[model samples]
Target chain A: MTVSKDDKWTEKKISRREMLKLTGVGMAGVAIGASGLGGVMKAMGYELLEDDSTTAQNKVNFYGPHQSGIVTPVQTHIYFASLNVLLTSKQELQELFKQWTPLVVRLMNGETMVEATTNTRVPTGDTGEAAGLDAANLSITVGIGPSLFDKLAMQHLKPTALQDLPHFPKDQLQQEWTGGDLCIQACADDPQVAFHAVRNLVRAASGKVEIKWSQAGFNSFPAKGGTPRNLFAFKDGTGNPTDVQELKKAVWVDNGWLKDGSYLVARKIQMHLETWDRTSLKDQEATFGRHRDSGAPLGKTQEFDAFDVEEKDSNGEYLMPDTSHTHLARKSGVQMLRRSYSYASGVMSNTGAHDAGLLFISFQKDPAQFIAVQNSLGRMDKLNEYITHRGSAVFACFPGVQKGSYLGEALFNAL
Target chain B: MKYKSLLSVLVAGGVLMAGCGDTEEAKKEDKPATEQAEPAKEVDLSAELAAYKQFALEQMDQFLMETEKFVNFVKAGDMEGAKATYAPARMYFERSEPIAESFGDLDPRIDGRLADIQEEGKGEEEWTGYHKLEHALWVENTTAGYEAVADQLLADAKELHALVQTVEVTPDLMITGAVDLLNEVSTSKITGEEEIYSHTDLYDFKANIEGAEKIFDILRTKLEEKDAALVTTLDEKFKAVDDLLAKHATADGGYVSYEALTEDDTKALAAAVNQLGEPLSQMGIILE
Candidate 1:
């Protein structure tokens, strides 16, 4: 259960990228290891700086009936789908970004506007153009690539080569997609929306691009949304952070490439429990390793309060069962920043039923770290027996603040 | 008795997410990470992007093909072609239904329309005979009953065909209109006047265990193609479940038994179902 040196990076507050920018380039990752930002830069192809410049955006959305569908029978009204878009890229890297900026503004529902930063309060309105924005429930994310290359490499505004791909350059011309592209984090509210968006997107890509294969479903999953979000009764992500708990940054702007800005995005295909109700509450608690009364691990009462493994009796043995939810979560060394929502089956009758269950979501710095948390939930967790895995997909987003500069998206062809 | 039948086929075949909206929804819950690169001294930048592009294209290509193949079966009337194809289809579904449950926010109208097919059994000819199958899918969500109704419809269609050729009767003009029913179905989400079902309704949030059991039984007995095509699809599906099981299993093993897994994980008391149930169902078909 011991974490690697990468563990400490996962615990920082300002985010290693932002810190790197503020601390000065080259000096970034100076204290870290070979496997640290510097080494990862060599293997991956990125640059890192601890500066004060604006960053990429993180988008998380909720698509389902406008209201709750778990316990109420309100016809699962207000059909809507929530999406979480993440953009991880470095700005000041791309050359012909106009074609890309318009698309980002349209998708994120924000407009290019103007205003002036003041001496006191937070700034109102941007400094460039002027207009209104409409990102309904959509959120576009942007994150600074944290790779060692990104930490130390100079901005890849120079020419680069992609001789590997047709129509690409061989001179190492910068901005040929050394970062990422919209396709890397592209998606839609519906299948047609997605298809159409991607069609327009690839047409926009005039150069060579390299996309991560693991994110094959970057445009799929959620398989369905909106009214379908709450047909069943189980609440998903009930324990997730709500509107900036202890983890949120103090200020977040939504303007220009950031109007209607975002936080982070999480995705999961939670198993439904239509047939799970047959068991007793006691049994159910045992399955989740947490108690139903307070949503805490067995032996603990408070919901959000941390589980006290040391709360033992005279015998000096563990208080909460080691196999309990909180115990295992702690032992597994992963935290659930989860935020779940339910979806309803489009059709249901007296006998046959429709689909319904939780769409569990969470966010963290490294997928591997979050993975550790999810793994604990997998092992000996009380909920395991009653639930089964269905679908899975992953994405890497950037902290977006500039138009057309999505993480990895801009560099999709460059690297 | 809750007669058992876990015969669940992928509704509307299997739709693939073709663009960005696909990523935005799921993107909401993840922590964004920026990947970096090495200085160009030794690494071949062009070679790298090239290799990555090939891998991406290949995977996307396979997924699209698989998705299209599944949907075409239904629209082309092949879903009912093999009775046994239904079982493996159910197995794929039984494992998926729970996760599909997230569509808790669906409009009952969509499901209601489909439910009417079974309850009233009157919309069969009224919904434009030419593309009755398409209507059964888009308007009614009758995917679960296609097999049950195909036989009856086949007989009816044959009789209609004879009457037309012999001049005993005129062909139902409506049948001719079934022309682009599939294209229509595909565009239903876009052009439909009313807000019926959304992408969320597509999820199987809950398990229709009873429905799945019924379908699997039939599929086990009659699916004809035991060859590579059938085996491959079935294998990929099972692999999906196996991967999930491995990811979610408890550390000590014996994670959740099939029994535990079957019960609604979200509830404290799910009902019991019969071990086996009758597969006989009165289903409908399209004339076109």
Candidate 2:
């Protein structure tokens, strides 16, 4: 526990083959031999990364110009946790982020979080739930909330665009789940891997932060891989900004330490499944103004056909109802990158209805972009009948990692 | 009628004798039967249905009376009075909404939110309900050009009363209604956004709880027979929630503003509702 925190880089960087030669650890007996040599390296703040070429398909690069999770192709599962900073000092927060960087790398590379110790007296460094699992293309994204600045006395460093969201007309936000000081979003094709990332991260920050709230979500991709439907069974992310150029314009921030970072707006929108299940198929289609089965715009043949919001029907009515969700969202004209997933938490304790809805996540250059769309969604969208906005938050995601430097290192050094 | 009753009794006796014949072999073998056969007793649910209908009709009558008062206040341009009357009037309708919603068109005309009929920016002409009146009283702060809607609201309230009289109530409907009432409140009212402009969601919340409680009260005797423990706990939970809500009642017996309740208060209410909801859901299965 009293080991030096920063000594690995000073020592020689040994290749895995040399390390294995120096200390006989092979693929078959790797688990048994982990405690002997790997434990020592780990205690010295180094975890050996073997060249396992088979894992090439299962790993996402941890160091990039932009974080991997945001614009990376969406994963099948997510574990999003918003934490309340328990540490009072900025240095503590900075050190925690530093410690997390390599662990994230190891996890994404499908390597053990820490050396496997044969010692049974002490708690295992890793939970070992994902022991035999591959990485499954895991990505972990970290972010800081608006309240974090005040806590660290770094309010002057706060992004101008990072503010608490304004209350919409129909918003009924729950206090317990609404706000946090920091957030971590972990995504993976495998649920266990996703949960493992968040679990170990939380474990690593044992005394520095406490989970304010967390939600587990999942998505089912078509065999050919296409847009997935939300709990409402409508194709979501249909109109998201997908191109890197479009992302730069609409998602990635362009100034300060957050130049390559983006703002995340998370909303826990609860779908009233019981009520929705009772509604007629026609009424359901009319509510979203899309054919539920095809997910096409009203009167349109293709799902991706541009919405003709103003086109008139034979009856002189708008082809899509003006109060429809897509029309209003399209009217806002504020494009953001959506990476939402559906979630179901069994029956709501009070209502006896399915506690399910979209864990709505969107990335943008500024929170104002999301606010504009939400303002447009204010009381008039017919979709409001079957859904309720129960929780909301805003966070400024840290810029991508550079090798040898940790997350948010630029911002901390600037100060 | 006497002759028919006698004939049915004879037929029932014949079936009972035939049922006894199956046991003759066992008696001849001197094998002791595990238990004696009990006569099948008929449970008439018509009395419960009639009582539930009467209760719904009575609640509608009160709803119509309140709507009349609400409309009068709107017509006189007494904005404050109309606003005060708004949520209280909604209580009667919300309490009997399961039956009121049986009339599909009437429910929308009477309780539809502004979102139901119009676009985001445009004023809605087709919308007419408690919410439309709410918007006029709270958001617009005037009742001008709302006279026709007020008139129509009263007409609908009366129609709902008449319509409810014709609705067929069954044990199953009562059970479903009890569960749905809780769902309705938890989904919308508990958040205190159902009456967004007026902040009068507490009235609706209390009404919905009481409405669900009414069905429980009607069926408590039967439920006690099936599962006494569940009935006992549900009764206690309802009382606890009602006691919590009682703290927010104004001097005139209307609820306090939804905004006035503290976060702790809201959480306590939610916790209580959840406690009652679990057992309330079990009612459907047990009654079946």
Candidate 3:
């Protein structure tokens, strides 16, 4: 998978205008060999590194101050994969990242992982499932897990805050779903595009890594478009940190090799739909501490209307039940950016119940923010009866890649 | 049965009325009437469904005995012995899963994987089943802490066996049960996810196929009467799947470890199961 350092295209810098023109021509059924596409990409990579072009249809940039998927407005779908590293050395791991950087750019550009090949004898470089689809706002974020540090013998470089989460009460975590060496959180408006990004990336790293466990999830927005409702029929992500300053304070780390990067906490929470469906509508609303139709705090009329968690009614009873999910979470007084997707894989074969839930993902400066909120939910959150934490993982997502440099370059430089 | 008989009588009356019309028109109507009457000779499925229930009970009987032996091995802290008996004991339950699943919570308690309980939003402490012991034997490589789980597994198996006797097997259960059994194979068993640590998925795979095949066998005579070509297709597809599975069989009547199969072998098996599944899924509609 190594690209030769002395390749002619690696040295040739092309202008964005010229590169777009050439790629546009190529897109119109021009026959380019696999190597030819690689060369063209190397040249285009240098030009597109500085700023994201507004011209590309529904595209997200590969290079930025922070990773794309973290605060990139929630997409319609996510294909999150946790991978186990098979590589033995840190140098080999570094090489794999270098090999992936340009490919990531190509996918976000709505281009195939590699150009279409005329040779039918070999499997296509790209799986070609997402062919002819636009970029669909695809964003790929990569992160390193705690186990990867030990595997590569670079424990000293591991972040102090990045470690396995403590077992929360009632967490029924499974080994297969828990930890991973690394993670790729690919999200896009189109399900196939999100899936294609992860598929091509994993395929490229074939022998070097394998998916430990992966889940595909989605969020369906209303026609008017607002916070998408989870499977529980409550508008989620309503309380996420939205403003730039709040995002900086809560999400992006400000120091060390991880400056501007964030810690990603992923919890695979399975929501029992059958039980929830049996409950009354009023109970469902009380369980979430919000109106089921308006997504507002209890006793409020609008989804974003402010209300104190401790607000009491005229009768001196708390308006928002203290045991409610939102009340407990707000009492923690910490916030993390929630970018979650709901999943409905199929029914449980034995009981004929739905096998569905939320792929709960959050980004925080330190994982303690998420931990504090989860601890606040604790054993008493009314929502616990309908949900279980099945899988959990935390990863130190790298700061965004810079032009002429690859992913995780800061960490390697520190070493 | 009453509705069908009434429908046939109405058709016979319509045919008699046509006999009062012109001779050529009556002759034309007579040929169509006989064609309609052919289906009126419908095979009664009650006896076949009853036979299916009996088969389910027999499987449950064998399941209890095998589970007891497996439980005893675990209680004695015999890792090798428990591991050896684990998948074979599970085979009986897999073969009659549609019947066992009908009983409330028993299927999950006896056969639930760790993920299954978690998906049900249950706590880990509530996970008392065969896979719990399977994890202890294979992953932990010690049955020392699993004596209680072993006892619970046997008790659940016994309860399931007892409950099977009360299950009323309708034609719908048999028809959909056959399709469900095949689906169980293609979805999880084919991926070797059911027995993650033990890698004895092939045993469960074969058992599910046999269970589905048993239902098909009982319904074969009636199905052939309705669609002979479909029955032929199903027979050929089932044989194709069986032939592929036979290559992986061991002399001890067990199967090769699921992990031992190559990528190509797994794909080939998946393809065969899918081929069989297409025709098998139609059995319900065809029977209706």
Compute DockQ for each candidate against the true complex.
0.01, 0.01, 0.01
Model 2 lDDT at residue B35: 35
| CA deviation > 4 Å runs, candidate 2 | A1-13, A16-56, B1-288
Q: In candidate 1, which residue ranges exceed 4 Å CA deviation?
A: A1-100, A110-137, A141-270, A313-319, A346-354, A403-414, B1-288
Ranking by lDDT: 3, 2, 1
Which ten contiguous residues of candidate 1 chain A have the minimum total lDDT? A161-170
Worst 10 residues of 3 chain B by lDDT: B279-288
DockQ of 3: 0.01
- TM-score per prediction, in order, is 0.32, 0.56, 0.58
Could you tell me how far off, in angstroms, the CA of residue A401 lies in candidate 1 after the best superposition?
2.8
Q: How large is the interface RMSD of each prediction?
A: 31.1, 23.2, 20.1
Docking class of 3: incorrect
Per-residue lDDT tens digits of candidate 1, residues A138-218?
A: 332223222323333533522221111121111122232222222233332332333333333332331212222112121
Query: If ranked by TM-score, best first, what sequence of candidates would result?
Result: 3, 2, 1
- Worst 10-residue stretch by lDDT in candidate 2 chain A? A29-38
